[model samples]
Target: MSDTFSPRTLGILGGGQLAQMLALAAIPLGVRVVALEPDPQAGARLCAEHLCVPYTDPAGLARLAKCDAVTLEFENVPLEALDFLEGRVPVRPGRGLLAHSKHRAREKEGLRAAGAGTADFAVIEAESDLAGALAQLGGQGILKTSELGYDGKGQRRVQSDAELRAAWDDLGRVPCVLEGLVPFTREVSLGVARTASGNLAFGPLVENVHRDGILRTSVYTGGDQRAEAQAREIARAVAEAWGLEGLMTLEFFELPGGELLVNEVAPRVHNSGHLTQDGGGVSQFAAQVRAVLGLPLQGWKPPLPTAMVNVVGVDGLDGQALEPDWGAIDALPGTQIHLYHKAHRQGRKLGHVNLTAPDAETLRSRLAELERLIP
Candidate 1:
């Protein structure tokens, strides 16, 4: 805390949970955050100043350009908006990496170009492209829109031509990528933060479990030397290639026997990394704000090993208040809960619980109990 601090303003492009957390982290550092989002009720509204305009609003962009720097919570920011901001203010992770992460096909190409392995794939821009894409991908593949897809949406599994066609139709036949589904035993993600000056901080390679394609739990058990090393190497390569600053997360499919293939990348804070906030050390949100502002970034190692379980609402629930008993969560040993302060909806990520323990087995046992309690 000895470093000299200055009051500064940071502009954020989205007002979702990630931006909300970033605003919370910035408040302690004497930095102010302003967020642009179309939704007036966005999660970040509680923590930051809101510009309730579309991402590309000229007045909004002009106002945002006045901040000391700019960053985004999600990858779907329009390229024109970045171009506008890039000409006026500093945009962390910059246009190159954002462009790469926004499109699935382009992202995979960038990953492979950065020396990370990925699923074999081909683009399916139309129905006529489906047959050749399937044949090339070996008769079965996952069809996903090349853009604006997240949280298990806009993607489907297809093992036959009829299903592929149906899946594409279901997805509105948008520009898509048909990928050979990875055969893997585990899915994991690594989050890394890099400063504008090129110093890097890598989070642990945590194991992830998903339900219906949305992450439900992320556990940090540690001690996978092979996977850890691979994740770091790929992170370094991609950061170096794209001249990355701020945070970028690499999600990987860990094949049996410790081999890892890149699955996806998010150029901002990620859901899987939420455990970083409660691990008895500096959180990823603070690290991201530091990185983009060219401040010194502390290493990612947290004091207590921890795990997180998402608080996801079930279907048929929207506009309903989840007035759960916080006393119950507070009573649990070494447990903390984070609620997004938003209304509930089916399959929506409302918050997460972080559980800490002295060792992996104890942490896992606590995590299971926490999951059941939250549901």
Candidate 2:
């Protein structure tokens, strides 16, 4: 094993805030980062070598291949772009993991194969399959596209054949999955890190709160020992099944009966894991930098009783700007504010607040207050 993490220049496939934070983590360790993104003002431009071009632009891909290694900031990077870099650069966590992250049906299949439980679902390849798939799931399901869906986009709740057909059509008649809704008590997410040597580390199995199908907050409230252990074990199993080599975040639905149903997975640093940057410990971004360089993994967990609230900005389509009261947020005790260098847009994550307390109850209270103040 290498005594030092070796990727002197890391390449990221997208230049969103996740890329921004990843570069911030890497720079402290003397690793330079390059980001290829179409958005000229993308967040990573502040901290990384920005290539403001499409993901598949030949010149952009050529520049990325010059980096020591490559990874994704988001899962939707076109597979052909990866194919172009396969032998030219090391793409940690690789294209197979990206494949599952890109397609809901493949993600479920991979999860089941990995000994992780998922909500019962049927694949809809066409309109003729939608009715039977709906009936198989008790005639009620969330119809979601197999690819290119996130947040509340590309999904619809349907209870009948007509509704299912309509959802399929509305979603552009793409391949889809209709999943039975689980009777969940809460949603949770776990960030897992693995290395080429097969070492594994885990973040807390933190409870997550979402609104309008987007994550609003993630809180690690001195979580249940048994459930946390189970979540980590499941993550390890999934990592093995998926050939994971760096950071990945998995979403789960915690049922009232104390079981977990895997909901979704992301191949890079996640919105829910943003609290990792605080607490004076190794973050998912740091771990990713190390993993991509083949460095040893360290620090399995973060300080307990931490929470993060996303600062969603105003509706840009309404021609509004976010004039945040920065002083007000800074005045709140233990709050660390991180803003992405991007314009305010509705449904876009502009920044986040991470805070901690000596215990879980106080942390939850602070989180509620922070959430109220974010907008």
Candidate 3:
């Protein structure tokens, strides 16, 4: 926690692009990251100094515990693993909040308790219970997995009773949460960081666009007093309520009548805030590192307007071509692309590009230009 204090090692769970980016951001600060992931080809493996075997391995937690502090890039790390290591090493955004995020029902319940708005929902544990929950929600709704679902996985839209039953089966009959469909205007997310000392910081609001459950692009819409204030107020309340001490992103639905409904909560650096790397006072990764390391939080200040584009696997495109594309993103005005160095796989997150401009209109135009250039 000292300014001159250097940690010999930082442990990370779920070594994906998020961990990789956190490691990259921590280098200048003299922090070394060790990650635990099953796949050797994971994005963070390229950078982490050590891999703690595979996650869920008791031996792995024991190994990672030798570090000064442990943090998880993904929330899916089993609560048991974290609980086992809790007293041995410091884990930021600790299990208290993460335990809730792992389940959709708990997440919604927590959001409502924090005075945040969300679509009407009910917990669905059986196929027979689906109809009643759907009826309570009225008309059509989306069924989200209770645990371990992300990027549109483990979820389905149920408009009919037949679809509800099949959707329940499709989700492997796991405990689920049913949410009434919202006629949302757009999806926006707010990224906030809270330090162990209770210092909190909020970032710019971003309008996100997702395709097939995968985030495709994020447009950094500058702080609207009403929108940003609402999001910030809600995030701060959640952090204080949960006593969260790490970076967290709150995804919200901006609905008609200017109301915002909580969509989901990500207790780490989020995909929607990728634009912060190039356009914010401090990138979300940097802020996360700062918070987890017990450093002071930075205030929210965006570079006018920013746009972030994600790179997903595409057919017939040589993976080797990514190098030149990186050059293109770098050469373009106010744009930066981060490649995850992951093995080619369909629908997997490969990397992201952050672009900024002097204004929203210019940012939009630049984003459109990059869109054509990416593919």
- lDDT for 106 in candidate 2 is 95
Candidate 1 C-alpha lDDT tens digits along 1-375: 344467888999999888999999999988899999999889999989899999999999999999988999999888879878897999997888887899998999898888899999988886678766787878998999999999889999999889999999999989899999788999999988898878998887888999988998998877666888889999889888877988989999999877889999999878888888888888888888988888878866567778988888764356555543467777878898888887787788888888888888888887777777765
Model 3 is weakest, by summed lDDT over 10 consecutive residues, at: 315-324
Whole-model Cα lDDT per candidate? 0.86, 0.85, 0.83
Each candidate structure's TM-score, on Cα atoms with residue i matched to residue i, is 0.94, 0.95, 0.93
How large an RMSD does model 1 have? 2.2
TM-score between model 1 and native: 0.94
The alpha-carbon lDDT assigned to residue 83 of candidate 1 equals: 76
Per-residue lDDT tens digits of candidate 2, residues 93-204?
A: 7987877878999999999999999999999986577657877888798989999888879999999989988888888898999999788999988888888778887877
Off by over 4 Å in 3: 1-5, 316-331
For candidate 1, give the lDDT.
0.86
Identify the runs in model 2 with alpha carbons over 4 angstroms from their true place. 1-7, 315-325
The residue-by-residue lDDT of candidate 3 on 130-199, one tens digit each, is: 6567777786899888998999988999988788888888888999998999999999999888888889
Of the pair 1 and 3, which is ahead by lDDT?
Answer: 1
Which candidate achieves the best TM-score against the true structure?
Answer: 2
